[model samples]
Target: MKITVSNWFKSGSPWVWLNAGAVAVSVVMVLGLLALIAVRGLGHFWPTAIVAADYTIPGNSQVQVMGQIADVEEIPAQRLVDAGLPKPGNKALIDRQLIKVGNRDVSGSDFVWVVKPWLQNVSHPKDAIALERREWGNFYGFLKDVRQNGSVVASGTEAWAALQDSIERAEDIYSQIYKIEKKEIGHINSGLERLRLKERSLELKGTNTPEALADIAASRAVLDAEYKVLEKELGDLYAAFTRDSIQAQTIDNNIVDINVSKIVRAYQPNAMGFFGKVGFYGDKIWEFVSDDPREANTEGGIFPAIFGTVMMVIIMSIIVTPFGVIAAVYLREYAKQGFVTRVIRVAVNNLAGVPSIVYGVFGLGFFVYFLGSHMDQLFFPEALPSPTFGTPGLLWASITLALLTLPVVIVATEEGLSRIPSTVREGSLALGATKAETLWRVVLPMASPAMMTGLILAVARAAGEVAPLMLVGVVKLAPSLPLDGNYPFLHLDQKFMHLGFHIYDVGFQSPNVEAARPLVYATALLLVIVIAVLNLSAVAIRNHLREKYKALEI
Candidate 1:
């Protein structure tokens, strides 16, 4: 072989060959992400649609669970956004509660509202329901009733649905009232005409004229009173019809008697746009997300879990970043290279090596039952015995994660600081810049990219680490979200829902294991997406900071 001048273009050394292998790894990673996303997303599209039969429920009532069919509303993409509420406008558009029953076309406005994930052959379907009764009703028929009103209440889908039965009933009543009012008024008018004719006859009377006048006058007065009553009734009818006060919601009386006035209950397709429904795929997605925060199958949706995840991550980041950065700065710039530094370095590295499950045990023992219970006694006395800080809290979870990831942040930050030249620091001191000022302005900026990278990695690792969180902050189900409808309502003490736990519960602890498998894939897809998003954000930030520093490199 010719000993050509060695260059990158022609290099065949093992290191160069390894560099080439990196390209293959990159290709594999990209393909893997794509394939996983497709598998999860398509799984959402092809959800099992199993129709449930009418089974006898408690109190001798029968509930029918149709099946879990493609909602026609479910769309594509992995990693679903949070589905946490019963919000009215576009907010409720993401709910995948509507099922595509039989040949029903969901794209057009014509539909019958059906319960999502139509429960099939369950001993009890009530245990899985999150909303009021969902039965077959003509969604289009309700719209027709609204057209007769020619108002928002008339033309509106939800509004008409809300009062469909009442509107139809009101229309009927008004029709009857229209005929009765006309007939009663006609009768009264005729009576008045007869009374006038009688008066004329009395005036023409000879011996009996005066006696007839008194009797006729008495009859006329009674007829006039009757006319007044009819007029008032007509007026009341018109007023009631005009204000839409008489419109009522109609459901299968056989199913539920939802009093629209006193205790109004409404069904809504809990999703919006084409894509959102596509993501929701089958009603099972809806079933998977919803719950009352206690039962496993309740359709309250994974709102609590989402809130917990975001809130905990934010808290963890806040706690870990400053502390980790400060420790790194002190070790790199201020601490003498003696026993203290050596000891700290060993401790920091050792902390990283410790198993994550150990941290969870620590959190549960020290944080939950001990520290949290103590705080419950002092600060939240009213909520005591319930264990405020003593229980798994988002705050505690965040703190726990912060503790677990601190070493990674510190190590990365210290390495970044060490890369800064000693000459630069000496020059800064010679230029009369204080150590603190130089470190703050020059050192930190240079090290920020690395710190951010560390944080990114920490977030990626922490978000996926279910074992530690399983012990500390996360719960199988949270009753109310950590945030709620109270004054200054974001409660840190509250236990939170988590997607990881959902995967665990659905995969292992669920009664309907076969039904829950698709959900497990969907959840796994979501977790992967969440991790990717965090990592991508870090990569973007690092790139931007690197660009900013490149100009300073010369």
Candidate 2:
């Protein structure tokens, strides 16, 4: 048996099995982590039953509490006493629950911790409502009545049904208001800014003559007229949206008026059926993917962050690919294999090991403060002080990342070029092909797979980088997307959002820590999926190229 084991080790079978076991363990660990995230993150969208309970204190009157159960934990009873809460008994361990008693406008807090033993009565009221509002996070209450123009139109059993209908109508009007504000008015504003810049340019060149001034005036007049019309329409829409309101009674029995337009969705999770829940879950997932964030990014969707991350990655790929490939080709095909070449190659390898934040600092100084400021001074003087490209933005961010990942591509491409047999190049040369033609037509094609492999690795690393992006371009919230319907649809100078930064900000910087926790996991899962999708695409192309060049290699 000892001889057999020794022979297996000598034959490398044991090493192969050890490596296979390590790989299997890694995959399982990764899947397990993803599963945990999915359960916690995706479950956030599901409507949880709101509980109404009477929380009793040792000396004070009983207080009614209502909200979803957000989290639970066990702690030593001594800890509660140390924290100034009255200890119930001499028990070593006690259960504590964090309740999401959202009504931040009234209570000033969305979450509160309560000792489970201090509860007098705990119940899930069927009539209880959980209102997802555009502001104030959420409101947990009972629907008292629905009103239109300050008169009660719905009460008792009819209030719930009426509230739903009013919300639908309000949402429709809200959509119209959004379209007018972001699209129609946004376009007019862009045009007016352009006209202002044009006037400034003409003035600087001493071309502000009567004819030019008159034409500018005419264009401004047209835009001003359009803006006035849109402004009036927006006012009318807002008035219509605010016409309906609902009166809701909090758990403490205070009646508050809530505008229907402010509510995103309202449903009694305790009363919802399976199909109802499925429908609600689907809607929430869609909203998370499509809508804008609200409540300091603790609530609502992350669409802007998603769009920004994908857009930045694409721009980085476009900028990096050609430059990396070209540099690789020059080094491998043209440059002599000597000491200087070896030194350059060594420096390129060293660059890959540099901290990513160093690249951010470099980009900020050279690209934004230097190159961008010069360009603004030369061609965009009218928009000076405002900075435009002379700030951290999409273009600078892309360029910085391209520089960071350049070394990886260079190394990969060179290895591929080296792997191509010298016989292939010599044969092409013998067939009356020039050296340039031989290198381009024969050598580069085989190296295409390696180029893609480098890109895949670059994307995987760049997509998840938050520290570098925060300095270069990523913002907590971007009002407008980098790509829009403006004259130059793709705005390289615009500041943009990113998923990695969103996760960091929402997870760490949010005032409501408990509320933002699940969102952190969800955003993280989404970022991983995005990187995986991009890497898989490049990998597929690489595999195809390898297959295409297989016969030549053989």
lDDT of each: 0.61, 0.92
Count of backbone clashes for each model? 41, 0
Identify the leading candidate in terms of lDDT: 2
Please list the residue runs of candidate 1 whose C-alpha ends up more than 4 Å from where it truly belongs after superposition: 1-15, 22-26, 46-300
Give candidate 2 regions above 4 Å deviation. 83-91
Q: How accurate is candidate 2 locally (lDDT)?
A: 0.92
TM-score against truth, every candidate: 0.58, 0.98
Q: Write the per-residue lDDT of candidate 2 for residues 437-494, one digit (tens) a residue.
A: 9888999998899899889989998998888888888899999998999889999998
**Candidate that scores best on TM-score:** 2
